[model samples]
Target: MSDFMEKLRHLIKGGEGCIDHMYLDTVAKVTVGVGNMLPNVAAAQALPFLLRDSGSSASPSEIAQDFESVTEQEPAKVASRYKQYTQLYLPEGAIDDLLDRRIEGFERRLRDDFPDYDGYPESVRLALMDMVFNLGNRGLITKFPSLTRAVRENDWAECAAQCRRRGIADSRNEEVRNLFLMALG
Candidate 1:
């Protein structure tokens, strides 16, 4: 039995600082019909699980957890809440479009922040995006040279190494390594 708010906080930390079901449930109600369609305005929802091999850029369906997958959990509270607040109970895809928009926004923001950054393919984008999402903008600065070198050489292993860290609770971790590997592919 997960408290909605507690789970939502973990989601912000767990899913690369991305929105979760709770986020959507919270925001969806406030949005007018047209406003709901906007990604920034769209709500985040919490799934019961973290994704398997899922990293910073993971989608809701990608979440994997030990105790339960989101698939195992019902959105009874979520659906009812949506109806109560917004007078709408959304179909799944209703939020997917918003997810895509958020990803795009993340990439765009990075590009804008690092205007001098060299060009990169979508894979490079994924690696950096995932890491930044997991950590923060400061992560880019901390791993700047290593991340750049690994991407330039197309070295997934090296990219994983570059993402590595210790001392603080922060780490590149197995999940993040999988993301870099996927990016390499």
Candidate 2:
């Protein structure tokens, strides 16, 4: 991975803790492996989930059972608590792969929206990627028109002012703001 990707991976993992087991996110979505949401049973089944005890590959039925087990539990519990609902886990390497795939997919969407994405300074790129990671492509694009306009116009200070997200920690917001500010220097 490039240095930027390595740094981004660390940043995202820190923000979204890596959980091998499926759990309900704050919004009750079935999520695993650094905030990866499995929207349906088929999405969960498509991954290579392993038996937590034996580390053997899980059968489809076992995966489905585990998925259902997790879904039945109360929503918004701690991620570790959800482990009790299933005997399945995603291996660490698989988690990394999933994160990589998500980053690549988001990058594609970002490039589509910002044709100059690749040419931006490292700090600008990092801030934008982190924003895209937190807010989906459409969310960032549609919700934050001022921030997108600032970015397209290379107005780093404006970007910093407009990038704050709801429900995110203030520290994370500051970090993104600082990244944009860094681009100013």
Candidate 3:
């Protein structure tokens, strides 16, 4: 991995704790390792889910049953609490691969949106990648106009000022702000 990918992986893992079992996110989305959201049963089935008890691959029906059970539980409950709802787990190697794939997809979207993405400073790239990871491609682009403008202008201070996101922890926001500020030095 590149230095940026390494740092991004560390940051994401720290921010979104790695969970092997399927659980609901803060928004009630079916999520698994590294905050990977499974939008539906089909999406869940695509993953290499294994039976927690037998360590054998889960059948499609089994995966669906577990998914349904988890989704039926109280939404937004603590991630640990949801573990009881599913008998399936994703191996650590599978989780790592999923995270890498997610990062690459987000990076591709970022590159498409920002023609000059590769030319941006490392700090700026990191900050933008972090934001994209949290807010997604459309959310980052359509939701934060000022931040987008600051990025296009290469205005690190303004980017820092405009990067704060609602619902995100203050420390995470601060880290992103600091990344943008790093570009000014």
Candidate 1 per-residue C-alpha lDDT over 50-71 given as tens digits, one digit per residue, 9 for 90 to 100: 2223323334433222112222
lDDT at residue 128 of model 3 (Cα atoms): 91
TM-score of 3: 0.92
Best by TM-score: 2
Model 3 ranges with Cα > 4 A deviation: none
Each candidate: what lDDT? Answer: 0.43, 0.92, 0.91
TM-score of each: 0.39, 0.94, 0.92
Mind giving the per-residue lDDT tens digits that candidate 2 earns over 1-185?
Answer: 79999988888887778999999999999999999999999999999999989999999999999999999999998999999898999999999999999999999999999999999889888888888998999999999999999999999999999999999989888999999999988
lDDT of candidate 3 over 1-185, digit per residue (tens): 78888888888887778999989888889999999999999999999999999999999999999899988887887789998888999999899899999999999999898889999999899899889988999999999999998888889999999999998889999999999999999
Q: What are the RMSDs of all candidates, in order?
A: 14.2, 1.2, 1.6
Ranked by TM-score, top first: 2, 3, 1
Best-to-worst order by lDDT is: 2, 3, 1
For model 3, state the Cα shift of residue 100 in Å: 1.8
Model 2 Cα RMSD, 1 decimal? 1.2
